[model samples]
Target: MIETYLPNVDWTKMWDATVETLYMTAVSTIFTFVIGLALGILLFLTAPGHIWANKLVNLLTGSIVNIFRSIPFIILIILLIPFTKFLIGTIRGPEAAMPALIIGAAPFYGRMVLIALSEIDKGVLEAARSMGAKTSTIIFKVLLPESMPALISGITVTAIALVGYTAMAGIIGAGGLGTLAFLDGFQRNREDVTLVSTVLILVVVFILQFAGDFAVKRLDKR
Candidate 1:
């Protein structure tokens, strides 16, 4: 019955492609979150009046973030090819896609992180400092807690973007649903395959959004 309407759809290959897409998204999200969070914190803390404020450092960090965040993802992938090959040993599979995915997503996520952290109340940070809280304590206890909701929201948006990035990466032979859709579906004139792959990508994105919203709701005290 299922195959009646979509006979060209290869369930086995679709499953494998779905797994590859999920693998790429999951691994990249973890790295993007950590690296983005750190970058955000650094940007926040080093801004004009913050604890680690330094004109040169803040300028340099912010400039780098803006530069990478400004690049188109597909272009970024192409630009990173040499580095990706050097780091991943090949640029044609799920694992090889990681370097480009993370590098492209991280700076964008970092900017999001900076936005989330900036929304934090300065008085709270000042209070923690006045109480003699260590920098680490202030970061872990004050800044992070106060901005938890925003941070979750930001990452949620970034994760969704990463899904799109994975699709773009697929066009370049990165081995995911994008690859399946473009190579197996589009090139082979298999519309059903493309449709099925697109549907699966949407499913993954919806799940990420739902989970992120649920987490934000739980973490948000106000």
Candidate 2:
């Protein structure tokens, strides 16, 4: 059955495409996690009831997250083309698509992170404060560690979401499994390539979800 539609096409090429997808997804995920976690921490600390609460800071962070989250990924990609080209010297590959992915994913991930942090026990924070921990110490040593399980889950969710974004990036010529699928399946009318790409994407998502769940369960005391 596999031989019928994809005949004579190198399977290794598909492997290369899959590697490209992983490359884009991994890089974007790391940047998004860092940026999102930082923004999330800021939002939590500056919210009305937190120790470092400041209305202005809270408002600014919230506004920035909302602004980025509101922009559609495809539009953001097109809108960012000039900047992407400037950074990457070509706006049609995985490297070129990265900045937009980071921009699109970071705010959404930030909001997720904020929610996870907000769910941490208020009592734990108070206990940390009573220990005379500084703000930075409380955030890094207390809040972050306490929310590890939730953060792990959030990272899994973000990874899967970014996979979808990577597929869309393929539309703009970012070579990956998606691009191969699009060209062979959509443009060239080969259903087998499409099927293979779809299955590969699902496999990757399942792996991410399983790994994330395992980490969360391992870290979660309750």
Candidate 3:
């Protein structure tokens, strides 16, 4: 029986890993949204036909977002090691991984935001302008409010992606369910431990999706 050969799982370790993973995901998501929302707004405003309409600004910012988004998460983590060390004093642990997680997710989420904002009706902006709305008013009142649902859904997606990143973060000593899966499960040949960690990650992601969707439905006017 596979169960006969299966090693006993350390549930306390699994619980700890669950907590760490949640903490990392929550902190990283907050950081990503703060940075990404600003970039996304800039991208929407600076586009060729958009309100700002600065060619140089659009190209530079768009290029930067693309470059960061194109990097694979695993390699991105490696590339961010020095920056991480500089920020947090060590290249290991949840705190250190925040930089990598934020950097990697922010740009990707920014693009999602760009798409969300771009999809809004041009008439909305036109009406706001006709009403003598200032740029700040257009952005705060019109742009963001119209795209709130999409933004919520986009962040929901980003949170799910961060779940994957958190697991990989464990490879570099960024503690989480990932570390348990690696060191205790695969390295020790404890399939039971591996299965439990994997299951927990699924549960977390599922809960995020359900909660995010519920909020989107509640907040969405349409």
Candidate 4:
């Protein structure tokens, strides 16, 4: 039945592509979360009145995040070709696709992190400070704990965006479902292949969203 409906679909190749896409998304999300979290923390702490407040630092960091975040993902991939090549030794394959994925996503996620952190009650932070809590203590015990729900929610959105980016990267030979869809499906005029790939991508997105929502619900105190 499966073969009859999708005659052109190669199950083996499709599975490989799905694995590659998952690998790229998983690895990139981990790096994006860490780097974005750090960037968000820096932006939050450096902004006017925070413990590490420094107008210059905040401005510079914010500028960098905004600039990178504003660039379209495809353009960002092209722009980062040189850097990706330098870092990964090739601008093709799942590994090569990672730098662009992480770079494009981290800043975006960073903004989300900042938003999440900002939503935390300022009074809690002030109370921590009044009680002689160290900066690190406030960040770990107060800020992160308070903002975890939002932070998880933000990363869920970023991870879904990365799924799309992987497809775009596939246009340039970054192997994944996108590459499979473009090269094997579209280029070869196989609508069945394209349809299958689209279904799989949707499946991945749905799983990520469900997992994220579950985490947020568990973490949310209110």
lDDT of 2 by residue, 1-222 (tens): 767766745589788888989999999999999999999999998999888799999999999999989999989999999999888999887898899999999999999999999898899989988989999899889988989898989989999999989988898888888888888677987777788887888898899999999999899998
**All predictions: root-mean-square deviation over Cα?**
0.8, 1.3, 2.0, 0.7
Decide which is better by lDDT, 2 or 4.
4
Each model's lDDT comes to 0.90, 0.90, 0.92, 0.95
Backbone clashes in model 2, listed as residue pairs:
none
Return model 3's CA RMSD, one decimal.
2.0
Clashes within 3 Å, all models in order? 0, 0, 0, 0
- Candidate 3: stretches off by over 4 Å: 1-7
Q: Judged by lDDT, which candidate is best? A: 4
Worst 10 residues of 3 by lDDT: 1-10
Residue pairs with clashing backbones, model 4: none
lDDT (tens digit, per residue) of candidate 1 on 1-222? 988999899899999999999999999999999999999899988999889999898999999898988888889899999998898889899987888888888888888888888888888888888999999999999888888898888888888988898898999999989999999999999999999999999999999999999999999888
The alpha-carbon lDDT assigned to residue 149 of candidate 3 equals 93
* Number of clashes found in candidate 2: 0
Model 1: worst 10 consecutive residues (lDDT sum): 117-126
The sequence of per-residue lDDT tens digits that candidate 4 reaches over residues 105-171 is 9999999999999999999999999999999999899999999999999999999999999999999
Residue 106 error, candidate 4, Å: 0.5
The residue pairs found clashing in candidate 1 are: none
Using TM-score as the yardstick, the better of models 1 and 4 is 4
